[model samples]
Target: MVFRVDMITLMFGLKRYHHLLILLGFIIATVMATEAMIIAAFPGIEEEFGVSSVIIAWILPAVMLVGAVLLLAIGSLGDILGKRRIVLACLIVYGAGVALAGYAPDMPTLLISRTLQGLGLAIAPLAYALVAEETPVEWVATSIGVLAATYGAGSFIGIMSGAFIIEQIGWRACFLVMVPVVLLLIVFAWHIIPDHGIRKKGKIDLIGMMLFAISILSGMIAITWIGLAGISDPLVWICIGVSICSLFLFLRHENQTEDPLLDLGMIHEAPFPEITINAFLVVFSFFILLQVMPYLIASPAGLALSVIYVGILLMPGSLTDMISGPLAGFMVSRKGVVIPFILGALFLLFGCGIYFLFPMTPVLVVCIWMIFSAGMSILLTIDNMIVVASAPPGSTATASAFLHTIQSIGGALGPIVAGAALTLYAPEEAFTVIFLVVLGVSAIILFQSAGIRRHLP
Candidate 1:
């Protein structure tokens, strides 16, 4: 018998169990790729449906809302049942969603189909939880970094190729192609990902899940509308009201309940809150860059670069982002999370400061973006590791869901902040404002990290 070694494992320093890592990475990639591809395919979908952008815009928010709303429920459920079981179910739903989304003949059908895809969003959190449970403690950051690198690649491919696929083949192709890919992954995951019936003993916290769903859904609706509708919009106020009341109730319940969706006592412990808060800030800060860069390159006020040039210019950042993930993991393993956290924040701070102070030349912007991407990537990966490390023994998934939803709120705000800044000011001034805000956010990260380091042994 001949034995073959995976070069990928050798590169990552993961011994014999790299297959699990690869499978999880593929799952993350699929989710991220689908998101990017669908966004790219949106224009074609709009044309086909013969609907206004406003009418169709709900699709994106709807997808995100489902994920945010169900994350806690699903993650908690996964803890009670089993992560592998829940993940397999999610993959099935997502595959179906992708398949139907491709061939949907009407707006309603497409909406339903895509919403199904949103249901699968819990898989990413589950993936993290699985890694925490299965991998050695020392390798957690490195493993997650590899997955994050895959996310970067998936996003890059989806964005770059999605448009071309939309133009050459059709919008449906963008989605249809993933169906088989997902199906194959489902098979691999089902057979190989382990189902030793690992689960916690608890009842599903239905009330907590309901309140959390409403809270997240309402808040997201408000965030989605506030930029377009302004602060005074009645619907906006109504959603905000609901979100706040529900969130208040949800927290109160978590504190008192026997079968809580999230263990409030556990999460409230030191470093966890710190980790999540920094996650929110890093997500919020980097998201602004994601929203602004395309406009910066394409707008007459900025570079006015051609679409082709835009992809070429941005590719380096994504590539660097992909590379940085494992490297950051290595750093975390050697030096611990606080050092990487501080270094990452400094990278982000410097990136924001340089972009703010200097002119927007192509070379300069790319370099700044690379630095920013690296910084954000590191923080994002570390955030997951810390959450897993801090979570109660069997509740990694639930904790991850909490972190993701909070980060989602920050991610959601990225566009609103950019829109308000850019809409209210000249292009140059808007860019300045955006980076300045991120700089401030990064400063918070830096201060928090410094504080954390002071307390570390």
Candidate 2:
């Protein structure tokens, strides 16, 4: 009887939960590809639509606005609703959005379709939460690492494949490519992603969702308009003011509510706050590099390579991400988290230093960037692990969403700050500013490395 029960448990657990990593990988890769392809195809899209660069930029801004506002709300809903149901719904919505985007006849239609895509994109964090709950403790880091690397993988694929498709077919073909990919991935996800047996049954906090969404919407729109349009615009100023006021109210609402969307107390954990701050600054600093290398490679300042060759340079950074993510996970699982976190920060600092000192040498720069990218990947991969581990049971999704939402905000701000630096100084000088900030943040992390290790699993 004992042997039979053990066998039954093995069969059910193995069949149900073993491939959580793989499913999350597929989700991350698909979502990243979707976002990256849209960004890569922007030039072609602008030309096709007969719009200015600024107008084309609005496409992504619109998508991001929706995502920034709604991700936490959607994630909380995932807790109330079944995560699998939300994942399925999001996949269908994403696929339909891709199809609509592919056939968009004008800018308005494209904007609408992209907004739909953003709503779907908000599900990415929910997927992360699902993986956190379902994956075994032994391999959680590796699992999250793969999910982290998927974004880099997607960016690499999008930059390379989107350019090829635009060259061979047209910009519209890029959107069409995702439709099939989404449909296929969704089918696999439905098959493999096991249902976590615990379910929360309750009414979602509608008031919290509305206030949070409004706050995020106003903030994101203000930021977007300031970055792409002029900050002096009356609309931008109004949005900024409204965002501030709304966010204050939103926080107050969440704080007073019996069941908050995000319980504010979780962030008070030692590692959680430190890691969150580190992730924000590191992402903010490195994301500038995303544009920097591409700009240098495209412009006269650097190699002036074709989009194809530039894509190759991006590969090292992404390939490093692919390797570092899993390896960081393993390190955290075995050696503990602090060493990897410190090392990741050091690599980012090194990358910035190299870029500042050797701005003219493309090959050297790429090599330095690989170091930075690998380190950044490690930090990100481990940070997720840290966040999940730090949180109390069942708050994994909310914690993950909170961290990622901040990282997204950092990513949004990075280019704007870097772009401004570039306008004022040489590329090297701008990189100096970026890297100094990164190094300063890393130093802070290093100082508290011992404290962080104390808190980790």
Off by over 4 Å in 2: 1-16, 43-61, 105-108, 225-236, 300-302, 416-457
Q: Residue 427 lDDT in model 2?
A: 56
Pairing residues by index, what is the TM-score of model 1?
0.86
Q: Give the alpha carbon lDDT tens digit for every residue of 29-129 in model 1.
A: 88877766655454456568886433455555456666766777788888887777788999999899999988888999987887788866778788888
Model 1, residue 20: displacement in angstroms? 0.9
For candidate 1, which ten residues in a row score worst on lDDT? 1-10
Clashing residue pairs, backbone N/CA/C < 3 A, model 1: none
Per-candidate local distance difference test: 0.76, 0.69
Q: What does candidate 2 score on TM?
A: 0.84
Best candidate, TM-score: 1
lDDT of 2 by residue, 1-457 (tens): 0111235447666534445566667777777666655544544565678874345545655565566566676666677766777788778887888899889999999989887887666776776787777767666677787788877787668767766676678777888988888988788767666555345555556787787777766765665566456678898889878878888887888788887776777787677777887777767666656645555665544566655555666667767877888888788778877788778877876766665565466587568768988878888888787787776666666777777766766665565554545544565565566566656655665565546666654
